[model samples]
Target: MKKTKILILSAMLVSTLFSCQKLVEIKETDLIAGDVALKTITNNEQGIIGAYAAMNVEMGILLNAVFADEVVTADFYNAATVHEWQYTSTDISIRDSYTAFNLYYRIIDRVNRVLAALPTATAANATDEAKRSRLRGEALFLRAFCHFELYRYYSNSAVGTDLAMAYMETPSLQPQARITVAPYFQKLKADLAAAKPLLPTDFSGTNVYRATQAAASALQARTALYLKEWNDAVTFSTEYINAVPLASRANFPGIWTDANSSETAFKLSRTASLGGRIGSLWRATSASASNIGGITWTISQKLWNMYDQANDIRFSSYAKDEPLLVGSGRKYTRLITKYAGTAYGTAAENVADAKVFRTAEMYLIRAEARAENNDLVGAAADLNALRAARINGYTPVVLASKDAAISAIMDERFKELAYEGHRFWDLKRRNLPVVRITADLPQVNAATTLPAGNFRFLLPIPNAEIQANPVIQQNPGYTN
Candidate 1:
């Protein structure tokens, strides 16, 4: 099937708050926009590389800007104390998030343009058919991957009977601006399925740095689980995990710190010239030249204490020392240290790939699915494999029942996937209680529940999208 360009309005048209760096720029005159560089076959390869590069520029600031403060409110914001009914009305986060949404759409636009151009380009003719197919598959997988992330945040919860947020399929040029949740998942699933067969089993000769079949499988599993397709979740996740071995315990830390690695399924590539890096931008202390100055977020003391011992390698990997500005107020004895480097300082700006999907996540999914399916023994074994790998001096999992096993799985996911965008979704998906907190406000009761139709869970449809595409309605709660 022919792919449609899904460009939204130009970033220039959006509110001024999100004007960080252009998410997708394709000026032929400037090599960075990925136009002239990707005009030919060899250049097309570079263009693909550049497309992945855009993710770093788009996500680096946004991740720290939105996630650091929003996800772990209990750590810094006293989220547990504030009532969800009373979050900041003028939250800078709203504006920051709007900008991120704009940037991500732009990134998707570029990937679409590349996918569109690839078929007719000279590069398409010169490369072997298999190589070409692999490259195209990587692009599809990536496009689907980004769209999925967009859906999760922009749309409402898909729990019980509620459908997810509307999916954005058409590029900005098309008049059909929004599609419903059912169709959105349909399109995302199709893209993932199409990409699956074309992708290589493992990275080899070419497309090594791009998404492979395993990556696509991993993505399929993720999307499936989000839609609550337990069996499909088990199948695809198993496929992904079986194909790509998990990162050895010793090298786990390196996956977060560096750009290049065999274990990484798909990452946004960064370089000194491109102006993006996860580690340096997220730096806690000024000791590093590339440090972004202030550390915006720190690992929660609660999480830090959860580690079984002082000697666990995973704990040390994420622990860093930095001064903090807020709640339980004190300097962080150890900030999240997984991202450590000056390769992409705030100014020098090296680009790095955002690690989207990895093998470890698959294990977590399998554990969750099995527990949900009432296979307690199967679930415990999967969870234990990872726990043993990350924590030394581990004891065997002891839960004998399914409910106990499931709780263990959630806690394991919290620790394993910490800081990796899963926490917020997990909380929302399970329909857990969310209490917004504050340093200055009155304490909210811990037992306050997230109402069934709470609007905050869904981001108001981006204001810019509403203005440009009149058909795009605001999500249930936010003011247009």
Candidate 2:
């Protein structure tokens, strides 16, 4: 019996993942039997690296910015296509949607391959067996994390019946139907549960880049928030918080600068050499000698104003008033400097490690979960703690009601997670609209009000996948 080369999508790259570079395979088969390809502990460990390379969160970050009100196209040129919200029409903003869809599944496929090879792969000693087990856990974690990402982006809502992604465990070319939203998450939870014990409790050199017990818990905390499993959300977030406290005021800026990994639960290793920078998404590729970046996107003035510029540390940490000389004059535009690469302030290298999960987010999760659970005092404390760390001379406020606490938590999330990519989905999770600042509308040149439950919120399956698989269904409103 021959194995099916399960293409993650209609056309997917069979790229080599050593040293984090892509090399296309031109072979009759995209397979080497599991035992041969991953015959040893080293082989299995290295196989997981490919999954990490293919896991690109930057695509989702791009979608979160362009589709929602967090950003607007620069003054003259709209670098990317402005989104068209109608179900049947081509939307430029969401053009990256299919790319995101394709990427997550590609990650899943890479993970599954690692997993499929594990049982038969040789581990010569107890140390090797321990390492192998950890690899298996990390593979499972990646699968759960990627599936959760797809579920949030593609599902209309988290309701049980809403159509979500096909959760693939075993690799196969057989066509798969979309699973419902509920089971999708349940499967994700099961994978995480299986992954946790096999994973290490600590973060070491390269393991810091790989998923650990902390990272798995972070996923659980976040998933609980989405499912409104308030108690679990609070419990899991508190678990991460207890382990890694918030980065201090002095150290807070360093997290963005790649100066330190103070409260980082997990991050993707990106470098000038290995090259998976996220900065180019907001910055133009080429810039003249006089200017730093030909900034393609800027934080919406509305978002910019929300920052306490002088008082809030995030104001400087997330962006800068990038001064550019314009025709014998100087003008300052707010540039998203979050991904300013390893060169930091100078050189505009536009690359940096992608911080996938941080402890600060746990605080926010605890806050949101507490709010929804009507633990108003606890929610306020969590919210206040995060704000106090990020802001100078911070003053705490009481959230008189659960609604007010949730609202405040939303604002905190915006300020905390701006360019790091949570804005759009945060609103979508709450069934809230993408309410843009009136002035922000013309800057984007597209729908300013994306009401909750709109068809556009659910990204259509990439045409490649739809045309490739007979059993697949296009998302509810999108046409083939």
Candidate 3:
């Protein structure tokens, strides 16, 4: 007789419904037995795909922008609280935080279940074994990726200090205590190390949506950068860069519209039927209808001035100038069209594929790592390569010191990876101050500058998590 038991893992409500473009849907009733459900190659594939779908949501993307200085709200709402830096533990947008926490963990739970089941699951042939190995690697990658995201938000350390987060490895109902920052990173690295050899150099299909060997390396580089492992960061980033070359200036604009660009290492595929509201948050209903999205998060002029508008392709491709009435019938021109939604040639559809990783990021990572390691010349070369690709008639920047090179890399990251969610974390990781230019918008409070060591930089652990798990501790600033 087959043994069956119901497992409740934390606060996550594990539903059996699974669907993706490449993977077949798995129904709840069909997956009654855990062993039977994940007993086949197809079932395991669907399980991992479902985890990817859950991980690729809009809440984290929106929050990353709102909480940072990348964009500001034009209208009043609970999201505006995050924009103005006035959010608390009980704020409505805090629900978004809870959603992110739960979503990532849900991914972890799914991945763990798949990994556990894969050993016992029947594989008919060598092809099946290969698929099983790739799937296992993908699951491990997802597990590490999700945990890293959670660590960035929940953990307090800029460096790997003794900060703790609930590190769940197994699919169990037992309450888990938070692990320290170093141990959490060790686990993340271990997972990535195991995954690297198992994943393929390229995915089977035309879509680069799934995690590949390059994706694993890119993520490892990013993790290394966060951990201050400069040499390791450079090595992994270089490996990824060698595999995936940067998109030329002509092809850069197409990457956003076209899903199958060479520069995109890993991105979540979004269709009209199953899409996100990221475009709606950043884009207006029409070019003329400013602030129509309810929360019109316009780009700051400070960020706008950073680009060489005439020479740089990114400026034209990423930003749009629109007129906004500031005060007393005065017209103020603002850059409001960074993300003009997913209908490339047609009207805006308010839908876009969530960009997780790209080759350009690898270049930036390598450049930063080189700079950190005092290899300023090497850093400048890497930076110039990206600049030469993006900018017309590009002049290579010559830096006198390591500081100047580091600063240039930071600026490049801000311009290149603006809305894709790197700004806030970049500032946090470097211990740099978040100085918002509120003079442009008088509606913003005077206290706009968030110092490097401010407690508010670390988001509060969601109230739900706190209430559910007594072992979990809230971040220093937030009160339960």
Write down the lDDT of every candidate, Cα atoms only.
Answer: 0.61, 0.79, 0.76
Task: Highest lDDT: give the candidate number.
Answer: 2
Which is superior by TM-score, 1 or 2? 2
Residues 373-449 of candidate 3 have per-residue lDDT tens digits of: 89988999999999999999999888779989989999999999888877877888888888877553436444677
TM-score of each: 0.76, 0.88, 0.87
Candidate 2 lands at a TM-score of 0.88
As a whole number from 0 to 100, the lDDT of residue 435 in candidate 2 is 82
If ranked by TM-score, best first, what sequence of candidates would result?
A: 2, 3, 1
Q: TM-score of predicted model 1?
A: 0.76
Which residue segments of model 3 deviate by more than 4 Å? 1-31, 75-78, 97-99, 156-161, 203-207, 284-295, 322-338, 342-348, 440-444
* lDDT (C-alpha) at residue 142 in model 3: 94
Q: For residues 1-480, what per-residue lDDT tens digits would candidate 1 score against the true structure?
A: 123222234444464435533434433443554345445555555656666656633343334223322323323443321223443323444554334466566667766766765675564454544456666776777788778877776663454334444445444565345566777788889989898888777654335457888788888888877777888889998987777677766887776666346355665555556544454444433534433344445555556666665546677666644434234344343455555543323433322445677777898888888888887778888888888778877787766887788678777766776656675566667665443334322234433345544666555665666677776666665565
Clashing pairs in 2: 341-351
Model 2 regions more than 4 Å off: 1-31, 79-98, 285-289, 326-332, 342-348, 443-446
Distance from true location, Cα of 205 in model 1, Å? 8.9
Give me the displacement of residue 246 in model 3, in angstroms.
Answer: 1.0
Instruction: Report how far residue 318 has shifted in candidate 1, in Å.
Output: 0.9
Error of 2 at 190 (Å): 0.9
